[model samples]
Target: MAEVMADNRVAGAKGDGRFEPIEDSQARMLADLYERHYEPIFRYCVHRLFDRTLAEDVVGAVFLDAARTIRNFRGSEEDEYRRWLYAIATNHIATHIRTSLRRRVLLQQAAEAGRLGPHDEPARTDGPEWPQVWRAIQTLGRNEQTILTLRFFENLDFASISAIVGKRETAVRTMLCRSLKKLRTQLKSVFDGDR
Candidate 1:
């Protein structure tokens, strides 16, 4: 169609002389994927970083990186693309955290601006346990935190998680079980007290 052609997203024509679908083209596919997944990715970053402005910045950076690297992307399926995006996001967050001084400075600024902490905003109306759970998740290591976030928050299966985390599916499953067990133990006192 004219609209698809205008976007400069068509990779090439098929042997049948028909143009490939816009979604099949690397550039256009990323455009479509950005529309579909940006909000969820932002939400994940928000929960991961606990800072709205920083999360927005990170989301922009993630998509920008995706745009720059899309030509090299080999994902043939939508889910694969999703995993790839999350992997990129996870790596970015890790790199951000590794800069201890910069992270501390940012956290200080956020705190001074009254933008830090999960309690600054109500995350859900469904339960009061949301803040408590966030606190518990924050106490976890990077991989454990990422695994829990992808598994419970994103509701991704082990296979997708394995792809995102660069681990075997069985390893992902085992890690998830261990992470859940640790989270339970970490939160046991609060849960027991609530009972």
Candidate 2:
């Protein structure tokens, strides 16, 4: 934690590029940044991964990476910093999903479907196990999932999502609409199976 702070100190030291130890004020600022952004970042991870335990792990990694790089971070204010953090969280979750959890998610979805039969929507939609909906979400590409999580679950605007995803606002909006339509089509059977 101490190492995370202290990269920048005093006035013209930056031009000389000499490293100075962090003072109390800088430490406090770092603490404030973490306090301000930690929960939202964690929530993003939880929403994307659908596992609190895994989310916690991902959050830890994100903040650690942020801490290490915060000195170099160009963003002076919270909004830019927050966007950078989201970008980091996005990469971490995508990596986690790609490397470790893709097969598990597919298997879990299959098991849930097989066990629940064709009629059940979900036993508990609030928790990580929103069987039908989550299964449908799992079918989407990584960018679509990120867009949906940022837009609906995180309640972020399209422009913000575009910044995080490196796309234009229009592209973000278009992708979101297409993703929602796909999800609706996939879940149509689950919602209207009996009808």
Model 2 segments beyond 4 Å from truth? 1-24, 110-129, 189-195
Model 2 TM-score is 0.76
Error of 2 at 17 (Å): 32
Candidate 1 overall lDDT versus native: 0.78
lDDT string for model 1 (1-195, tens) is 324455454556777788765554566677899999999899888777766787898899999999999888887888888999999999888877676557745664554454445666654444435545666676677888898899888888888888899989888788888888888887886656653
Compared with the true structure, what per-residue lDDT tens digits does model 2 show for residues 144-164? 999998999889887789989
Model 1, C-alpha of 72: deviation from truth (Å): 1.0
**Clashing pairs counted in every model:** 0, 0
Clashes of 2: 0
In angstroms, how far off is 27's CA in candidate 1?
2.7
Candidate 2's displacement at residue 22, Å, is 6.8
TM-score (all chains, Cα) for each model: 0.74, 0.76
- Number of clashing residue pairs, candidate 1: 0
Task: Score candidate 2 by lDDT.
Answer: 0.78
**Model 2, poorest ten-residue lDDT window?**
1-10
- Model 1, position 188, has a per-residue lDDT of 86
